[model samples]
Target: MNIAIGCDDAAVEFKNILKDYLVSLGYEYTDYSEAPKHSSNLYADVAERVARAVASNKHERGLIVCGTGIGVSIMANKVPGIRAALCHDVFSAVRARKSNGAQIITMGSRVIGPELAKTVLKSWLDADQIDESSLPKVQRIMELEDAIQLG
Candidate 1:
């Protein structure tokens, strides 16, 4: 699956490490950051770009990184039709996709090490199918999002 990846200056190193990991895992990804080591754009801006790409179906999923991951997760979820989850562990990563049907996962560069991040990413990527029991819950989330956007 094609993945949209981006990060702010605070997580450039983490982003690069994950990018290489993505390649090693045989996944194609598009980097939305401005530069290799430094991104002038704010975390929210990068998150929105990646989230929109996934929401529009241009990419299958998105991975965003920030200093705390919270900023990007909140920003990405602001977009309509996007469920962005801030995940710090493999279980959360898997549940983000399996339970919430999240199309985007956000990670904190400063909070997680590279190996743990890779493990989380791998688990999330492997969780391709959403649980049937969670379908109604996911639908409710989308409905709430639509209602909020419409209002």
Candidate 2:
């Protein structure tokens, strides 16, 4: 699946490492990074763009990074149909996809090391979407989104 990736200065290093890992795994991805290390940019801007790419079907998924991952994740989730999961561990990464059908994975460079970040991304990539049993819950989430958007 093609993915959209983005990061602010705080997570540029981890983003680069993850991008290389994606390349090594033969996965295609588009970089939507705000800027390089020396530059300053908003994580929300990068997150919104990457989330939009996924929500619009321009990309299959998104990977966004910031200092704590919280800012990016919160911003990404503001877009309709974008389930951005802030994941730090392998289990959460796997469940984010398999259970919630999250289209975006947000990571924190300050909270986790590069090696662990790679592991989480790999786990997310290797996971499957929600099964029959979990479909209703995902559907409910979409329904809630719709209801909230309407009123």
Candidate 3:
């Protein structure tokens, strides 16, 4: 899978760990990290870049990290056709992909430890491997997006 990954300064360490894990898993990915280590970078901007890549078909999936995950999730979801979920647990991570067909998963560095973050990432990736059964609901979501965007 071609995954697009990005992070703000607050989550740079966790992002590096995730990148290494992704490499270990042998998944080809694109790093959209916004800044050098310890440099302040806006989470919203990083989210926008990653989300745009997914929405544009430049990548198959996205993973963004920030202090709480909420800001990046919100910003990513603002883009049309981008389903970004802030998942902090295994169940939520699975549901984000299985139920919502979320193309992007966001994590919070301040809230979850590195080990748990890895677990969540694995859960999300595994969920994506499963057969998706929520096309009807996902279609409804797309329809809503169209309606909202058109208005």
Q: By lDDT, highest first, what's the ranking?
A: 1, 2, 3
Sort order, TM-score high to low: 1, 2, 3
* TM-score of each prediction: 0.95, 0.94, 0.92
In model 2, what are the clashing residue pairs, if there are any?
A: none
lDDT, candidate 1, 1-151, per-residue tens: 8899999999999999999999999999999877436544899889988998999999999999999999999999988899999999999999999999999999999999999999999999999989999999999998888888889
Off-target runs (Cα >4 Å) in candidate 3 are: 35-40, 129-133
Q: What's the lDDT for all of these models? A: 0.94, 0.92, 0.91
Those runs of model 1 whose alpha carbons end farther than 4 Å from true positions after fitting are: 35-40
Write candidate 2's Cα lDDT for 51-117 as tens digits: 9999999999899999999999999999999999999999999999988999999999999999999
Candidate 2 or 1, higher TM-score: 1
lDDT of 2 at 27: 90
Please tell me which predicted candidate would have the highest lDDT against the true structure: 1
The digit string of per-residue lDDT tens for model 3 on 37-101 reads 76555888899889999999999999999999999999999999999999999999998888899
Give the poorly placed runs of model 2, Cα more than 4 Å off: 35-40
